[model samples]
Target: MAAQTETVQWKLGEQLYQNPLSGEHDVSDFIMEGQAAISFPQRRMRMENVLDPKLGQQANFVFWCPVEFPDSIAISWDFWPIREPGLCMTFFSAKGANGEDLFDPSLAERTGIYPQYHHSDIHAYHVSYFRRKEADERSFHTCNLRKSYGLHLVAQGGDPIPSVQDAAGPYRIQLLKWKDEIVFKINDMIVFQWHDDGTAYGKRLEGGKIGFRQLAPMIGEYANLSIHALERG
Candidate 1:
């Protein structure tokens, strides 16, 4: 298959967040700037919060890059935990041009991907993959990181993968598809693969925007983040 490549240097977005202080402070403390660093060991980009506390009410950091997929694509990010018990990442779709959620509350709730809090814990750290339903309200699929840190994939309509209790972290996750087979890999290790039979959810799996979601109890800081979209020719 033929493939294409694109590289993006992270930059400041149009929106930003601001904090209020009790009294007047030095002008330098009010200067805010967004910064990104690179780590060679992990081949990822680390983004830092550098917004001034007195400029705005909310911080909006957006990377508006367009990604086109020919067949299938693989997305990977190297995340270092800065806080515990938080959601380190999230993948969203821009299909709703009017700023509507592609996975509406109804579909998300029906597929068991809504609520967001359903998958949270102090020691939880794993990459998740799921396909949202555009037609049937009951169509969707999900894969989670087991307590043991092992990879667990499930077909919402099918049986779930028995949870394992192993420490699996600091590893890369790859989601790829070919013909009718979908594969999930960790650190280049094939953890799970499924036959994409002509099903409502599996058959329609293709193309989406990937983003990171940080949940509460902020246990650790996240750094060295990276995202790549590879298309098969």
Candidate 2:
């Protein structure tokens, strides 16, 4: 029997029930109730999270957004870090026909696992997206600007952006598809594009739940407080 695909939708002021797969943490610590809103001029919803220093062992939070992609997916958000020298965001997903785990790598390779470094003054702003290929395969991509650190943006098989020498502040990221082409932008500046020739995943599976993440080893306070999903036409 073929697996069934589920489509989930959320509107302004609607609350997404925190799923048990939300890991072993309390839902109240990660997501803020009624914090998601829509931006009229941009025609897109905005998800925001403000970090509180007194929650959990670390000062960062994680949440999951359930989505079904028919043709493509696009995500945009604004991030600002209170400090200046730590990883700000790391995105993750579950890839498979029935949302099974396939690309499970060691904690070192996966960006979310906390590192053993300590810095109280680090901060970052990031945006990213992924293209599903099969049940066990997917392609990952991201663009980010850091304060007190150079901004880095890289596509699959491309070199990392040379470290910038100045601090960048409050950048917006947009990911969208124009026909069969995928594009990535930072503060409205187009930085990367690729043709959808169906080569996103080399040989793994595809099609499953997508999510947002913050890179671990983060000190100080950070939050992925609000998240939502919708199907694209």
Candidate 3:
């Protein structure tokens, strides 16, 4: 049988949200789960753990953009890995399993722990692009995409990012989600593409919120975060 392929047929429409994420006031209304020391040392938002790293997951945190986005959209941002021995993730299509707001007071409270997210009451798509937390990660770099309500890893691609020592970055991280397709790229280079059939990973995840999560002891700087609606060509 001939292999199948999907044609690229969508374009980014009007931007839904944009933030420099550069200074103190840029994130004034942002919501945070767990504890992190957020600063703007180089005019770029820097985040790291406040609790001792030895505390494990308790020392990690998630900073949310607070804006709910539609199912089809394009998200772009600039990133810099300052320090490692930790991991970073992007959470999207997130909401209470019963369709409550991600921050809905009625849902279970979350504090940046891994299980509290995957094994708990919410559903979200998680992508770990900068994964250097474990010994294996440091030795073999890979970008992973997982769907949750359960930690089901669905796609993976080679991570082309260099380690901190050799990284000279303002790496443009881009994610595009349209219908069932998810594409991830760095500096215009395609890293991976997955087409979700919906039923395989529970119900198809639609519109919800987006958040930036970091494991303890990792320091990263971010700027120019923007989201554009995905429109069919």
Candidate 4:
């Protein structure tokens, strides 16, 4: 019913997928839904808005990896905050409510709209790790994990990433989903961990696509996306 309040020993299995995300070839198969510009000027994939920020929510977007991972896996990536004052999220275990592929043509149109992903026909677990958008959010920095077919805030933890002016460089971020539990870490420090009771959030999500989503006017860089099979030791 609960994780052992001690160091978790995981025997990571075969690497499922790996990408440097260094250039266009690495993401040639990726799908971008919304109006975001992507480039690799620094050998790292940079994401920013193509639309005017004054468009508000309409300027946001999601860039999705084409891989469909299994239920129990570890997703690891490197993150760099270039410019701030916007939210950044990672959506995993995303699929249609009835278990359709994330990009299925039958699925409702999604154009970086928040409600389209959370309130529409899809079910996903999204972690908002860099939340500095609004005035209140900037005042108190916290990483929030939400389960949706509805935006259900299930977990939260204090965010450790500093402001852009104070940020150092590529920070390692990892998200582990093994069975019914989820753990999020940054720079090898556990930011939050949660167990899904299932019934509370309808059902625990599993095995789907992973995507990077950014709110308007924010710029960020990403690299070294890797997913691995995980076994508890």
Q: For model 3, how big is the CA root-mean-square deviation?
A: 2.2
lDDT values for all models? 0.31, 0.32, 0.90, 0.90
lDDT of 3 by residue, 31-142 (tens): 9999999999999999999999999989999998888888899999999999998998999999999999999988898998889989999999989988999999999999
Per-residue CA lDDT of model 4 for 44-109, tens digit only, reads 999999998888889999999999999988999999999988989999999999999999999999
- TM for every model, in the order presented, reads 0.39, 0.39, 0.96, 0.96
Worst 10 contiguous positions by lDDT, candidate 2: 116-125
Question: In candidate 3, residue 197 scores what lDDT?
Answer: 85
Q: Root-mean-square deviation of each candidate, in angstroms? A: 15.0, 14.2, 2.2, 1.8
Of candidate 4, the 10-residue stretch with the lowest lDDT total is: 1-10
- Give the clashing residue pairs of candidate 3, or none: none
In the range 1-233, model 2's lDDT, one tens digit per residue, is: 01112222212222223232222242333332122211222222222334433432244333334443332345455433333222334332234323334232321122222231111111122233221212221223234321111232324322122212232333454444333444455556665554433333222212333344432222222223232332333
Q: What TM-score does model 3 achieve against the real structure?
A: 0.96
Measured on C-alpha atoms, candidate 1 has an lDDT of 0.31
User: How much RMSD separates candidate 4 from the native structure?
Assistant: 1.8
How many backbone clashes are present in model 1?
A: 16
How far residue 20's Cα lies from its native spot in candidate 4, in Å, is 0.2
lDDT of 4 at 212: 98
